[model samples]
Target: MSLLNEYRIRLAQEQDLRAALEMKLQAWREAYSSFRDEGFFAHHESQLDQQLAWWERGLAGGAQFWIAETGDGKIVGLAGGTPTIEEDQDTGVDIELGVLYVLKEYYGTGLAAHLMDTVLSRRDALLWVLEGNARAINFYTKHGFVPDGTSEELVGSWAGLREQRMVRKHG
Candidate 1:
């Protein structure tokens, strides 16, 4: 059977935090190795524990985190969004797609799209993607998001990386 057909998506809980973090790490290692500088991983490694805790707290706080799981029970992808209003009044977008990552093994199987649709559910939203992440840019574009001309340089743990904002509007 096709890998795409062998998986399902559902809301993520506190119990799924560690596996979701692993999937995020694996996806980042595989996908961003070329897009990010050589020191990216080394700089970010020390903060992964904090990120994991943040994910757990976000879940507890009612952020909509979702995971894609294989029939055999392995979690392969995750996506989440948060309600946004005050900070993005400039764009008028009310939601932010904060995280979307999938294991490299599922890159071509449409799992990322499925995970996104599960969490965002076609809502009009905004997201920041790494400036040079062509694969992600293309994917978001395919889903109707367009660049909104905002960019920022990440500092500290993700120093040297840049990001641009993309937005999709309600139809």
Candidate 2:
């Protein structure tokens, strides 16, 4: 059997937010450990309650989230998309691929693509990715996204990192 068969992807429910967020945290730790220190992760962890509450509100406000989980129900990946909130965007696409994350162990297992399809099946969309995240950038590129020459420097705890906007325009 294929390895992808061992996992399932489905729309995330209210109760699934915490696990999805936790999985995302693990993914961030694994993916960005080379650029960030333990303090960054700890600071993020300390805001867990606020993050959970924000996700709860987003779900209640109609944000869509999809999660990949094992047969035993442990969340391993998550993806979410919503209407673009950037007033300055001239990409001509309103759908934004907000988040896509999978545990490092699941890399190259096609789980990320599945999650991407769940949230954005061939639609014209846009997303902002961290400048140094080559893995994510390459994946997005393979899926038809390209940088639109727009970029921004993140503020607060994520200060220092730059993000570039990518857009996939469907003909």
Candidate 3:
């Protein structure tokens, strides 16, 4: 209740990896439990290793990491930006909004919006939301992300699900 209101936001550091990753997994499990199969959640541990790899890269890449933690240092949410400086086949510089996860307890409490607002405020960037994830699609729309008519299959087991690429440019 009031305790949740006192949460703070800051850049995530190396030591926060364990808490951050755990928060991410908890958020995902809660968000997609209804949409995905029971077997999916039951067999999801292998995916954690892959996620750990990416989190490690984020730690090593020096990209900005933002986290929302309670007064007790419990991480409730996280968001980050992963940028590609190299010229791409399509867009010039690709800046990916790579992380946005909030614990289930905070999902309806505006924490998602808060994390997203902070992420977008950092810079102009693009992100992909799985087409099947209706909740995320609506969330991104409210944040000023409109469909660019571009999509792709996200690598890995998500290859079947369409990934909608949306961008917000700041002038």
Candidate 4:
């Protein structure tokens, strides 16, 4: 039996935010451990409440979010999409996939893809990914997203890393 069979993906509710955020943090820690130290995660950990509040507001405002959980209700993956906030975006992409993360233990189980499809479907969308995260970049590329040549320097605890934008357009 496959691990994917043990999971279900559905729209996230208010109660799921904390677990989803913690799972996201774990994913980040696993993915960036090579270049980032404990301080980086510690800074993010200190801001969990702020992040939770932001998610609450976004959810209240109708931002779409999805989570992948086990039968026992352990959240292992999450994805969210919202209207693009880039005022100068020229591609006319209206949706921004702001988050898509899965626990490292489930890396090849297709849970991430299920969460992504649940949130994004076939919409024309854009997402910003850490520049050196080849796994994420490749996954997005496989899902029809391609870099649009836009990049930005991150600040604060993320100072050394950069973000690159990728987009998928539907005709």
Error of 3 at 47 (Å): 4.8
lDDT tens digits, residue span 36-84, model 4: 9999899998899999999999889887688888999999888888778
Residue-level lDDT for 126 in candidate 1: 94
Residue-wise lDDT of candidate 2 within 1-171, one digit each (tens)? 766888998889999988889889999999999778999999998888899999999889987799999999999999989888866367888799989999988889899999988898988999999999999899999999999999999998788999999999889
Instruction: Find the candidate with the highest lDDT and give its number.
Output: 2
Error of 3 at 25 (Å): 1.0
Output the worst ten-in-a-row residue range by lDDT, candidate 1.
37-46
| Poorest lDDT segment (10 consecutive residues) of candidate 4 | 82-91
Count of clashes in candidate 4: 0
User: How much lDDT does each candidate structure score?
Assistant: 0.84, 0.90, 0.75, 0.88
User: Tens digit of lDDT per residue, candidate 1, span 60-100?
Assistant: 77776888998887998988887775767687877889889
Instruction: Please provide, for model 3 over 1-171, each residue's C-alpha lDDT reduced to its tens digit, 9 standing for 90 to 100.
Output: 554586888888878877788777678688877656666665665567677777778679776789999988999999977674453225433677877988877766788777777877746677778787888888888777766778876655444567787776655
Alpha carbon RMSD to native, model 2: 1.1
Q: Which candidate order results from sorting by TM-score in descending order?
A: 2, 4, 1, 3
Query: Which pairs, if any, clash in model 2?
Result: none
Candidate with best TM-score = 2
TM-scores for every predicted model: 0.90, 0.96, 0.81, 0.93
Better of 1 and 2 by lDDT: 2
